[model samples]
Target: MDSTSGPLSGIVVADLSRVLAGPYGTMLLADMGATVIKIESRQGDDTRAWMPPVLDGKSTYYMSINRNKRSVALDFNDPEDLETARRIIGRADVVVENFKPGSLAKYNLDYATIAATQPEVVYASITGFGTAGGGALPGYDLMVQAISGLMDLTGSPETEGFRSGVAIFDVITGLHTTIGILAALREREHTGRGQLVETNLLSSAQSGLVNQTAGYLLSGSVPERMGNEHPSIYPYEPFPTAQGPLIIAVGNDGQFRRLCNVLGIPGIAADERFCTPPLRSRNRTELRPILVDALSTNDAQSWFDLLTEQNVPAAPINSIAQGIDYAESIGLDPVVRVGPAGEMPGIRHPIGFSRTPARYDLLPPDLDADREHILNWLGAESRLAAQSRA
Candidate 1:
């Protein structure tokens, strides 16, 4: 696909961030058609070496978030390379970085430094924590999960708190950073000046906690781990069926009524002890066995179909592969082939646009893969500037 066909077609992004959060955000911009130039150190992004899941010796983890971008490696210790890096930032419409706070100040690549000369440039900074007392601490997702109370709310009451299987906070921070960048860009359209857009893992984690945190603040009660059960919702977790586990989510009394009808237990929906949402949630222990026994009458797949047909939210617990297959079976097209030759498999961008669709023309680049092209482009711009001066 042609990059110019995307909504962010004319935008040029300088991506100085590495690893998950930074790269994931920039990849979203690239998906929407920004010309993202990934500036890395000579050693490359730390994720490049993260292995065990490699695609032809390439890091699948790196490829997952670095597609549709060009790579240029520059060492800050080298003055010429530093200058080139600055030039890339100078020419970019948007600059994204995820270094620790103040680390880029010495190199004159911080938002303040860049915004002083190029007030029209949208600068986005992602950090582990904000640039305050927590600035010195490293911002890994696991650490953020523990610090933000997510781990505490994860596992069952008897088990030790567990980290999520994915780097959820990093992903959340990246998404928040992307939204900030887009908002700043929109504001620049009206004001003709850009501002610093900042996001941190801890802050994003707190925001991601959403209702869990809000509930604690309002009621003065700390939430505990429930292991696959939602804190405020009953029948919102997995239940055993004849064949496998099935998830039944009943958000309101209407859904509960529908679910009960589908399970051939319509009378349970009217039971005084489990009538309202609050009552059902409060009396989940008494309600769970009743629902479980009813669900045991059929296989998970059968129950899923019956409940779904009745407009009740239900699903069979699927593995990753099964999930992908399920999405495809429903014509969602969850996977796409990327790379120049379309040989590499990738997850499709989640958003769907009517006028301008996301593109996957480029694959994740090897270290410094596009350095020569980037330098040549920079040189051409310099030549044009000299001519304009002459």
Candidate 2:
């Protein structure tokens, strides 16, 4: 157990989630010091089998988000186990699940069933689409990306559009779910009643599309794939340097001046055709050759250092390793060692609280790792309730 205190120190989360979206959300809550009980089936979360990146024979995919939580395995088909599952939810302050709509009702673990007994339960449900017309659709990140127009907005116009390197929508949906759950919990403080919070990958993808979605909705303009180019910003994509590509995000005219100065071509910043942001974007065809010519004099690393020192908003394209190294060099310790013995290395929690900080006390568990402990705790609670009634 984590000895550190946090804002959610006393909250208990009954986590019936699996895979990325649901589990990822619960992990955030767990990091914030919730007593997150991860309940898995006999085979465990599907991601546990997504291998080739296993550490100590465990799937790194599964390990990525399951830290700081206790694990319990239960079969709802068994009457005793089903009763125990219900009891755990009954005592929980929050429940996170990603089961298909109507599926959990049979197990008597649906929001309605649990809320009937535990009125203040904050029940969070995650889905692929939603509970309505898309109810039957399978909730996978790639499928949602395709159907939600994310794929159409990714990649270059000349190439077949590609899915993001990671399951972005799933992660986004999980974050949305986390926000919804927290909001519902706060609302429960006033109303004395719990509410159902729901998020789906498709809905999250549409919301995450942000400017692209708004462009289509407000202007009747369909946004298409622009590859690495930004539709509204000039020099926002990577440019070839002497040795490699460097990303230069010139957000405004001021940054443009700074960039031109760094390139030893300050005159380009004053040219009327490329002076302002909109002009630069409009006359990118004219501006690109000039910037590329200037940049070709220096390798990407040299330009990165020179431009960054001048606050020109630039960086050389770095791989995942280099990105982490860069973060570390700047004192953003992005990794943490979890578990009682610090046995596993996990990403550091993103948010920082001055007082009630996030905690990482447990490693990712083996299946049913906390079964005996959880069952004993439930048994103790049952006896207490019996005595109170008597």
Candidate 3:
């Protein structure tokens, strides 16, 4: 990896986590030029088997978050392999793992053991629940979503609650883990020591709930599923247009007035029932038909263009392909080529640093691809010690 420019240059990370959350977080660090050594099991990370979306018979799911990392497969049952893992951790500036609490203790790879010798190592632990009462529970994203009330809040009121189309909580937890790790690294500079940074999917999911969770805590009201309709905002959901559904998000009175004008219903904005946000939300049943009828006058694309020109936030719902195309059309540059030859395409890291931008110099490794190089590097120190004794 070219670790000469990005902010995390020279920082070495021992990545012991796998699947989504932990891999996602470490990927972010790798993008910023952290030298991440992904220590996988003999069979490799579980995502390596999450197929059906494969590139050249390799799991794209595994490739997505494994870029810019060097893979070293080892079996903890083998003393030599375990020693290699320890040597990697001992030389790392940061260590990230998501094993169940106490699981790594027997192998002496836990935080307490690592910190005993390397007090300045920043260690991060990701879990499904917390380390306390829910320590033993498996930390999967779907389980966290169900347990965190997110599933209860999704879907239409007439239907049973639904899980999000993607692993939303896992992504959110990964982001939280990244944030915590960065914060701990920053603190280490001032304190001259590192501490354990912990994150759980359930807690991240609740925090990601944001306003919905706040509403219940502040008002003593349990929010029910409203489908796409937001609890606090009116004209926030999709409405039928001539061609299809168009989403009109009128955030304030000014936007509402503009939307009304664009829909050719100027009188509706001033109507007492829809004058204010709260009133509009309370009287959505009456307002929905009015907006839907007006929006129906034009095709969804036409209305989207007109409403956007008038400063009313409107959009035609897009598919994943359309979403990426739209981003590219708007010059967002959402994709980048990875690997030494830049032959593989991957999603570009979202952050843009002015002075030190993210780099994509390495490809996702095949299982244990870097074993020879890593073994040689590890052996170098042992050779130096022997030479000194001589």
Best lDDT goes to which candidate?
A: 1
Give the alpha carbon lDDT tens digit for every residue of 1-390 in model 1.
Answer: 124689899899999999899999999999999999999999999999999699899889999999999999999989999999999998999999988999999999998889899999999988898999989998899999999999999999899999998999999999999999999999999999999999999999999999999999999989989999998899899999999999998899999999988888899999999999999999999999999999888899999888889999999889999999999999999999897789888999989999999988899999999988899999998899899999
Distance from true location, Cα of 384 in model 2, Å: 3.2
Q: What's the true lDDT of residue 220 in model 3? A: 88
TM-score of 2: 0.98
Worst 10 residues of 1 by lDDT: 1-10
In candidate 3, stretches whose alpha carbon ends up further than 4 angstroms from where it belongs are: 381-390
- Give the C-alpha miss distance for residue 214 in model 2, angstroms: 0.5
lDDT of 2 by residue, 318-356 (tens): 899999999999999998989888888889999999999
Which residue pairs in model 3 clash with each other? none
Q: What are the lDDT scores of the predictions, listed in order?
A: 0.93, 0.91, 0.92
Q: Which regions of candidate 1 deviate over 4 angstroms?
A: 1-3
Off by over 4 Å in 2: 1-4, 387-390
On a 0 to 100 scale, what is the lDDT of residue 333 in model 1?
A: 98
TM-score of predicted structure 3? 0.97
